[model samples]
Target: MEELLQQLAGKLGIATRFSDGGLVRKDYEVDDAVVRYIAERLGYKAGNRGEVEKSLADFEKRRWQQTLENIYVVEQGKLQFDAVVPAEQAQSFFALQIENKDTGIRSEVAFEVHPTDETYTIGKTIYVKLLVAITNELPVGYYNLTFTVADKTYKSTLAVAPCRCYENPALADGKIWGYALQLYSLRSERNWGVGDFTDLGNFIRMCARCGADIIGLNPLNVLVHSFPENASPYSSISRLFLNPIYIDVEAVPEFKPEDLSEIADKIAELRQSELIDYAEVYPLKISVLEKLYGRFMADRGSDRRNEFRAFVEAQGDDLHKLALFQTLYDIKSTYIWGGWTAWEDEFQNPNSPAVRKFAEEYADRIRFFKYLQFEADRQFKQASAVVAECGLKVGLYRDLAVGVGKDSAELWSDNDLFIRDVGAGAPPDAFFPAGQKWCLGAFNPYVLKERCYEPFIKILRANMNAAGALRIDHVMGLMRLYIIPDNGDAGTYVMYNFKDMLNIVAIESCRNKCQIVGESIGNVPEGFLETLAEKNIYALSVLWAERKDAGWGDFNAPGEYPEKAFMSVGTHDMAPLRMWWFGYDIELMHSLGLMDEAAKNDTYHKREIDRWKLLSALDANGCWPEDNLRKDNYIYGQGYPEGIEEAVHRFAAKTASKVFLAQLEDILHVEKMQNLPGTDKEHPNWRRKLPVTLEKLEGDIAYIRNIQAIRRER
Candidate 1:
């Protein structure tokens, strides 16, 4: 026991104390063993000794609890787990390694591998070969292997021998070959007040027509069934599973005609509404789904049941544990921000036998949760396939939020990884005078470095597997995060190391084969854009933000913007061009305190003149005669006159950016912003539904032609 403690202490590079009372390194002394262990884990050879030593020394000096916050170090092709330790306790350790004798070198580590073939048939066994390079020689022994691929986990064994190749044929192609992202309310039809898989599949078919290769969706991570307030997908209760709300109740095999009729009136009520009311829809859908589940159980030998079982098995123990946790969470009704340490002593210790026994007792509930995820995955894949059949190049580019909720599954499962005391947010910037304090907990820098960034890799794979392209919200976070210390004000925070973070991001991007779009909109550090460019990650160019000055202007000129970017007029957070032009109410703006009376008057007058000039130019083109223009219709509101949508689109089309994204709202001529910043219930945010249904949207000739024209020119 003393020897084991010494070895661990040496490897951890910290002073070790055995149960019998023995110490390896002094409390304040540098732990060489721990440093060596970290260095080896990071794949740095003797050549990097000096740098590793320096880093260890720095770690000791900086006693910040959140040391390895968001740092990613991939060694031997695998992300290293965080190796946090007191600087004085740095030390060295050894890992059993397997080398390839044929090459007389270490085998390459395998992070992830994708199928070379673009398409495959269902029920066909396919073999995919992976190459891994090991960094050290190891004693002959057997090792257990655990890997997650395509939302499925596979565990196996590898015998220590000289081998360069690791082949996995078990991960063969399935019936669903594509991935789709839920556009949420962006879809046209069959959305029971909110976008569901039905609408997603229809959109996928449209993508097929457009020649799109793959589709990606936002994190479909599950949320509590009853909570409609938490709209962000990243703040999920379980990262290992899927959100049940996305389930297409009618599509379930067990759904009966009579059950459907029972909910017909409720369903009809939902169809008439535009915005998604999850509180109402979720309950109604769940009631119908429960009925379906009963039928599914009755027909045990059915194909759907078998599929569900396979999915449950594939997800393994993780899903079961999370589901149980969710059940517990609901029953206890604990506050999200309340520290987990405060949970009843029995519930707090996740690994205790008692908890395990409890989880087993509630196995049925766990299975149900797993069943929902499996179905959601199936529907999402089918939707993606529909998109691939379309003609779009990148079918569904999903967005990944910067961090998860503090009380999320990630925090619960890996409490040590996140700093519960501190919150992650943005520093004071021009857009926001007060530093933003997002409630999400950030990974401790020190802890992350000690662990070698395994958590980040998990997140990356989750988003990458099903995406053709990924929009990293607040891409600048990869470089530096503003971490507000626990028990501190929003302004009390520090920055994390940037270079290390970028390296991991670059590697992940290469491995995924998915285009990366960094949302580098605000408070960007110097040379950050250049760095992202060098890494082959594209930038996000908003038409509103592309002007030479902060004021709005014609920004589509080629020389003005980066060529490799996704150009958009506005996003979900901003007002639609039409709304900004025609409906900028001064009273509302004043009430929101966006501007003072004097400043508002001056700005309003300047914008009115600018609108007149633009309208005059349009009238000169004879598109609309000067006399034909109705003064009332063209009246200036807060900023611009009506009829600015055409100009905005034209400007966006002409930009140097390779990809152009016309907001669904703009296309449908929606008047309201999907969400408003600063205020929540005061405004109708994420709740507004699209005015037109999916069927109507498809038949909207004008809308189709306009988008087609833009794409044609691109």
Candidate 2:
């Protein structure tokens, strides 16, 4: 029974063990209950030994009977694939035809199958290596493959991609620096409470004036519009679409600022608050948008109307599906209550009769939702255009979140691709001892491969079209994911076809002329960083994580940093530089009951030492401010001297890295983190607004001086 379970697990792509960053391997013994639960979810009867044996035999038979995979993706320099053929048919001639996806050009080759020495008894099959070496045959693009054997014809997709991702040409001149900020955190006098597309355009122009080439942003994926208070850009409803809330309502052609007289007082109140009140902001914007949408709908023969129609047609089914999902969600929340999970079984499937009926009845509402996306897309592009106009090199760097929420619209639209009832998360480590479950859906590796990665490709193309570069959050998921089943405790890792995934990324990167950066921060697997470097994917290097020795106080000098990396002082998940230097996070964690007294005391002691060591490292790297004191004379409670934050940013800028980034919070000397990882509503995560508005920031001496120093150092 145990042997049968092992065979089944192997076929399902579940890892029996995994090694940590330290190269210490730990094996997960086959647990009967966990195995049975996961198997049942995957549509297998694993209740008893006899059923398990049948499942294993069936899986093996299906795999052995297959002649070739549905899709074959290979790198440019290496082009080869294996074919499973009957021993008697091994000597037969096979005809191969390849047609380019973009161009209608076609090529053909004829060859005999050269079988390997080994043979499988399941179907009396032999492995044959079919090396495709044609004179100028395949380039870095997708192709339609046709293979013929005797009278039978088989079809599959062939993707020949570059081995490495696209490299920005600006890097050859010199290193470039940028500022990373949450878009909603930006404050402008003209905005309706929260930051909008107009603010983004203005901010981009301001950064360019300081000679910064890049502007990194938090994920702008669509979230639950009905419950706007449930805000966290990372936990989005649909990654393939843009968030409509970021649209600049007043900037719309049909919008009139004088029309907002009824809600003028509400907008002013929201802008005055220290934090963004999303609940109020969402409704206020919608009320004004509905008025503008009405005006737009009335303009029958206008060019803008035709443009919207053309956009709808170009977006096709993906836009329609998202609009439908949002419309359904709105009705469900109003009457049925809860998310899509609470809907009737007939309405669960997008193609079901009930859903079709609902979509038809509410077609106008769905069209309204689509209009929201249209405006959002239009504004986002306008903001992105500001990058080039301002002479920035690598402009508008966007972020792609790791996964979607469990009850996300993505799951509702296509349930088969997601492994329902399972979650993707981190294993127990130094910080999270009990382990963490993010409550996000894990992708079914089998389904993704079977679908020829169409879903994944669509997501890449969507985000890549709007930015000069894209940062994939938790890029390690391309290799393996720590999956925890709903019924199990800490679960095991599930491996993926990482090589094929990276090849696809390369194809998309080159096609869009966008560079790629992988966030490889915590609990990294062995050789992962090296693999990222080889593939031309920049690995993330946090300032705090770049230590030279065992002691936390010993930091790496600027020269020690890797050239192929995205260097930053901190991320949205960690404390800002000012907070880290002051040990404010330690105090906050202790007050939140996340750390005990002993742990708090020990962490504070180390933090004090780290403060001094950081200054010493900066001084060694020629980044320390002349007026700052680095010795013991600098007291903890007395606060850091002027230009301390700028010096920290300058330290990162002086690194050997090609791309250096400073958080906007750090540049403005904000002490709070944009988010605390574990806590959701307990801590005000993703709600804090920038203390300084864009109008003031444009002329603020400290802001200009801080950004200029980074530009100079780079």
Candidate 3:
């Protein structure tokens, strides 16, 4: 029991003090001594003791609960707390509160649309009016009135009606407005082996030519290091900043000089390649950037400096702190996770005068990081503007990850709002028996509400600022999160509150006029889809995950799909259709040596079932030869067993989803997936380069026509 308590305390980063009677204090108090002790234990420098004590005193005053239940136990030389909320208390705690007149003045205004006074008709259009009644005088201020539908925003004219009510105009159905593309892969000319902004521009042009209204890409979120080999945009260091790696250094106005001939030549060499090689491209780009920075510094102008300073100022203090953290990170190298809790005694106590003085001294270094972010934003916006010039309706749709990294800037800056001792992850399912531990720290539910949901609002505003649409990865997390306590196994975790979460999502989606696509996959609660639909959030339909059971029907069939959903054949996680069909990539298994006896048997059984299904489908379609000799030939063919391509197209085109996305890999006949989940080393994830360069892809007439045909059929 003592050992278990010690392990739990270590994992939670809290010190446990034991008394002679076997009673223990977890030291939930935050103070200089505690902070310094933790920092020293975590291997960070300590600054001053006096400041730490003051900060800790203030922190302890804040209302905090270390346990869900008011109960404690002691055994041997250790103590345990019942942190789990009891059923009786849970019911009362999680119950919804009803609005009352005494508590707050409230009124409900309904907007109704009526074509011919017959509202029940499906084809009839309706106009609605809003009515508001006030019992007391409201604050005088400018209030923005906006309306959103299916992620599209529009403003309604406000008029002082006869009875504080006004009727607005009605909108027609089936109007051909511009549709935004919500999923896109970036393309680059000099992307080590992957696509970049240059490729994105070219792809946007192609999309424009094909009558695509918008092109959405994965998150371009900033990372802590240039070489961590992280491909997920959702797992970023700072949500407010941009990834400098995506910056087009050549596009800078100062780079057009003739003396930069060598840099231009390097871009040319990279453009000729079909794949992106990040290892090679990152170093070369950084070296050229250093040279450019040197040149700019040597001939620095007052105007440029002022502009940079203004950019730094606009980011505000939180961003400055993040920048300072980054600089400290770079200097210490190994202290990537050394946040305030792990810093030296003086620094650990945020209220310390010494820490404040240190921040003042390193202010310039922090400003430099902010300047870098400002430049990145300026360049990316310019790139998007170019795409808009090409007549694309929605230029960029950004992705938002389900959660933040445990040691990210957001967690450090807002530690009180985040529960570091509990991590978010998926529960066990058919796909992964052991479940998944994402190593992400989620926001504390109680704290988030007490703070008026400020954290969520900030994230939403930041992400929507430069995006046409937003895809919430694992969108179900917004409703309920599976939380595993520190040092606890997956089975011991409990579900957190989700009612308030739904309201927050609705408010944000309504506020941001940007369309929302919920990646609603796996273990979703009953009626969750219905609720999302009610909130006007679109559903995502992945072709590979669709089923043809009687209840679910054939998702590939247009009539069977949901009208408000988006359809795609495969995502970055799955193997390309061709590879899944061929089963040629066994190197991943051999390299990782993860294929033990049990795994080998599981793989064999899974593959055999898939093979049988494929053969059955072909036979049912009448594509198989009737004659024994011809049947054998068809089965032994080098390419696909015939009719598979047509089936795939038919499956996608027939979906009832309003929008369909075709992967460039499938169009170009690429055989491997961009990423393989689960194994870090075994999976050659996020490293595969496109088979053809952006230039060559632009010229692929057959590939272009094939996609055009599919779109036309749809």
Candidate 4:
């Protein structure tokens, strides 16, 4: 396996070794057959050894050709033009011109060392400086550079970057607090079935009244809701647009009681269920949206019509493409397409003549989707405005899911930017021994560079446009991603130019004046956090995940947490505080077949010890009465105990971390987690609702106490 893997590794440009400590190299273990399978999967044809070797050589040549494209992207400033002058042609000269791709603004830049300069050396690369442009004249954005070196002309990219990323003044104070919530799980009477912007706005007021400064939400990325069962927000279709599911139809200005009378009862029935009925809610919401659209088009006054027109114009090609994609998706899924990849060729080609005709024929439907995104943005903006009006410092901190599924609108629209056949995920780690395959397509590094990273920039801008902050989920993807060949379960790492990516984040964050937080959890590579910290991006410190400084490696103390971190008792992926404390999650995992009997028993034993350690720490800190930690009370009892959740939250709040987030599950003391990482139909992920509605939270004793406890600790 080793010799075969090594042989195939070089042929495929994949590393067969990795380093964890020192500079020592280690051999990897990918079966030779596996690489052969991947090579064929990527459309390489070879029946014999010689043919396979030839194909591998051809692949390497293609990679080299792409690398030598001569496109260089530099931060905005004095443009530098570099060229080589032969010793015989030392007196040759060149001219440099930079033009803004979007704005059509052009400038002439001088080279640092011209060919006629006394110091210019023949056969040496000489750097020519272009005169620096005024910052006001040249805004922070992408530009095109055209260089003329004798008979040769070359084109490249020049991007202007802001000094540093934005960090909200309030969050920088080292003691602001927030509520972390899975937005869908929030129950409210005003929304259709799942939580909506209306609920978020109302909750913002409640949070402010309770002295909270920020409200963290789960990823709002658009999910493939046509198939309601797999509704993991992380596994979304498009991050560039908002999810239509979050639209509050009743809150629309054009919504009239008569318009939705036919479906009012269905909406009511949806709210009555404990678990969110996504299947029912999707169709009902669409019906309401259609009615609203009809009402909108009935009286398209110049003022309103122009507003929608301006939005469509500003959103540009991306929005129009997304609309067409959604329109075709709805049509084909409802009528023609059956299994995956069964869609016709024209459907696969987003810009085909047949597709263009279908789009023209279904223009109204396309506009409907476009309006859905506009409305979603409008309501979200209104919610953020409310937060600002209520005197909150940092509000609506949104999470950006790491990547999108392989078969998604974004990938379909911009297929070249994403790699197909292979899925992106994690390598082997403590929590996931076999590694994880997220079944998501990764951004093709080569295409991103060739395209000047417009796709990623668009995604970042869309996410940061309305929120006070952005939390990048699985933040490590910016650095390197694990790609599983042929969508299989295990994979190897693919490196990216993360430094430049981080710089872009800084530029966007500064432009928006929003702080950034990276979810740097579980098995992060060394120097990853340092890289994030250097960019002034905050870190997350899940209390349970932080290991003790000494002894048996129990949970760490709040004081030990970093000042640049957001301290939390638990995250959405893990069990709620009470569930973890009571061992309910472990038992649930066993029941769900996630663990065997032996593993369950061993886990429970470890859980008991960790519980004891937690109690001792809490007792030592005077968070709870020491009498609660008596040996007699520490037996095989793993039931929910009074005040433990609050104490756990208090421990988190007391951390030196600047931002402390109290999750909704801990506030409600819910046993079930919002998501089970690797499950689909086996659990009700993202479908669980709060035990009580938003209205009830204002008066519930336990809820109120939890709020006060967090505030007091903060």
Per lDDT, the best of the predicted structures is 2
lDDT of each: 0.57, 0.83, 0.53, 0.75
lDDT per residue as tens, model 1, 91-132: 222122224323445433433222232221223422222222
The lowest-lDDT stretch of 10 consecutive residues in candidate 3 is 163-172
In angstroms, the error of model 1 at 264 is 0.6
Better-scoring candidate (TM-score), 3 or 4: 4
TM-score each candidate. 0.72, 0.96, 0.69, 0.88
**Which is better, 1 or 3, measured by TM-score?**
1
Winner of 1 and 3 under lDDT: 1
- Candidate 3, after superposition: displacement of residue 159 in Å? 22
Candidate 3 Cα misplacement greater than 4 A, ranges: 1-194, 256-280, 294-307, 334-361, 491-499, 550-556, 585-638, 641-647
- lDDT tens digits by residue: candidate 4, 196-309: 988888899999888898888888988775676567888778898888888888888788888766777887888878899899898888877888888788886757667888
- Candidate 3 per-residue lDDT, tens place, 1-714, comes to 244333333333343431111112121222333334333222232345443344343332221221121111111111111122212222222111112222343333233211122111112322221111222322211122233323333332111111110110110121011222212234444443345555566666767776665565777777665454655566786776777767666665445456357666666666555444556666676576656555555666757767766877777776776776666555545653544456666554344686578668876566556756776777777667765588655456677888877767777666777765667776555455566788787766546655655567677767876565677888877766655555554422223334445545544544454667789766566687887776566778776556575223333344666766667777777666666665544435544674565765566555545545545543453433444223333333344644454445545655567556666666666677676667665565665665655566657764565455466455
Candidate 2's residue-wise lDDT over 1-714, tens digit each?
A: 377777777777775555444324443454566667677666666788899888887776666577777888888766666666667777676788888889989888543355677556664445443433433446799888887777778888888889899988987567888888799999988888888889999999988887888988999999999999889998888888998889988888889869877878888899889999999999888888888889999999999999999999998888898899999888888888768888989888999999999999999889889899889989989998898789899998889998999878888898989887788888766677657898888778778888888889988988887688899999999988888888766776777789988999999999998989999765787788889889999878888888876435478888888888888988898998788877899999888888899999999888777777887887777777556764575535456767877778778888999899888788887889889878877789999898999989968777888877886787
Q: Ten residues in a row with the worst lDDT in model 4?
A: 126-135
Ranking by lDDT: 2, 4, 1, 3
Residue 624 displacement (Å), model 3: 13
Q: lDDT of candidate 1 vs native?
A: 0.57
